[model samples]
Target: GRKGDEFAYSHVVARAFDTDHHQLRISSARLHDALQGAVAAMSEPMVSHDAVAFYLLSEEVSRHVKVVQSGQGADEVFAGYHWYPPLAGVDGDDAGATLDAYAGAFFDRAHGGVCDLLAPEWRLDHDASRALVAEHLSRPGAGTAVDRALRLDTQVMLVDDPVKRVDNMTMAWGLEARVPFLDHELVELAAACPPELKLASGGKGVLKEAARRIIPAEVIDRPKGYFPVPALSHLQGAELDLVADALHDPAAKERGLFAAGAVEALLRAPNDALTPLGGNTCWQLGLLELWLQAQGVR
Candidate 1:
């Protein structure tokens, strides 16, 4: 929590379990450590910036704790993400059509925001990546448009983002993490919850009710949030060079994941004024380089 958390830090920290941290700064060393773990964890070069940040935090907590429990599936199972609200408005035939459209956008940022930064000739087979997601969208399930949205997130977001981040980050430090929300019975219970209860106006209606008694109302009712690395601010000077070098590397050139002209434009940007897409791409390129280095590819 940086500044304006709804609940006092101490109470939120207690209830958040191992995922909570009382820090403000994101040092370069933590970023480097996270990239190392990302490379080792991945069989290839796919990156999750969200996981990179969390994995770094998990590394720190692993020093004191040998095992930790998380609320990973709870959000997906209980409909806690902000993305759920958009899907709740439609129903019946149009709802299915909307979900079909939404499925294409589930990873829209990583695809459109970051991947689109690359030149068409240089971009990876993003369609192949999207096809993989489309498979999950087509998974056997029964539920409303919102319920389908929840299932879609469970299939993609929960596993790819949080769970992977925690698992890799904790394991990098020889720690183990468990997710109680993923328990078989608990998952069934969450699945059985009504959409209106799980995904009200904003989202997480039922979870708020459950949290009301167990945790402070302020914490329960507060807007959702998560920690992220300060990559946008970190993208300048020598730090940018590390990323620029990676983009210009002979091996990276061979892979052709980015356009050389686009790389130079990124390097030439003045100060930290790049757009959200630009900042995210810089971080992605840097992490990919770090991962490649760990793989002995660059």
Candidate 2:
């Protein structure tokens, strides 16, 4: 109606089944497969599989539908990847040390690059610099550096990160979803596994090797590309201005999700021009405004 066109299309959507950071690159093929599967399932009378297929299909059809499914938890359950493998012939302790050293060296190089790019006023001394580097390297769990890294990702990424995009989009379309990955039982099982077994040198060492017999190696071994939405690109121009306006507007201040003066400062600050807050931040602000509006709080 907006475009004054008459057309009907079917969409088949799938959740992020893999844990790869770059979901776009990882899930492209899988998404295609899902859409094909949905279309095929639709042609036949609704079987049990079709029921699942159609639910996912409806999500695809909606302008902004977020389906909360638990593909990540399933991976962890069946030992699907994300387990850090020990380097060949290295003792557990040594393997941990090797990873830590590698991380530290990488951090130092990255810090140097960032420092070179930053203004002179932002520069810090060696101790401060190393501390900042350590903050980036540190993770949530106790144990080796690699273990901690895995824990951090599991805690922050797999558990909580999905909500940022998924919940927002789903709610935007007036849908509610429950993710099974947040299941306590599944997370406990995955967390109980020894790191050596999980991160074996050959990629999700144990899980991948085990799954090869059940699922084709091609399917299991396919490179993972997670949600690859060009979020930043989507949030530019009018969208960015809308966000900026909401943040700085007196009416937004009266609504009071944020401190009016602080929001104004953020808007007026020069940093937004040079290093604009990315789409995630903009989306979050928009969602907050939407929620406030719904509650009649603003």
Tell me, by TM-score, which candidate is best: 1
Tens digit of lDDT per residue, candidate 2, span 171-214? 44456666675578856765676666765534465567766665
lDDT of each: 0.64, 0.42
For model 1 the local lDDT of residue 94 reads: 53
**Model 1 error, position 152 (Å):** 2.0
User: Residue 77 of model 1: what lDDT?
Assistant: 87
What digit string (tens of lDDT, one per residue) describes model 1 on residues 1-298?
Answer: 1342223555565665654545534566656545556567664455555566656656677778889887777778888776666666655235446555565335445455555567677566656655664565455565566776777677767787677767776787778889988998977888898888887636777877877776766666666766544453356655566667777777877777665576666667624334433235565665676677668873
At residue 184, give the lDDT of candidate 2.
Answer: 80
The TM-score that candidate 2 achieves is 0.43
* Model 1, CA-based lDDT: 0.64
Q: What is the lDDT of residue 9 in candidate 2?
A: 11
Where model 2 places Cα greater than 4 Å from the true spot, the runs are 1-69, 74-142, 149-159, 163-186, 201-203, 231-234, 253-298
Best by lDDT: 1
What global local distance difference test value does model 2 have?
0.42
* TM-scores vs. true structure, each candidate: 0.78, 0.43
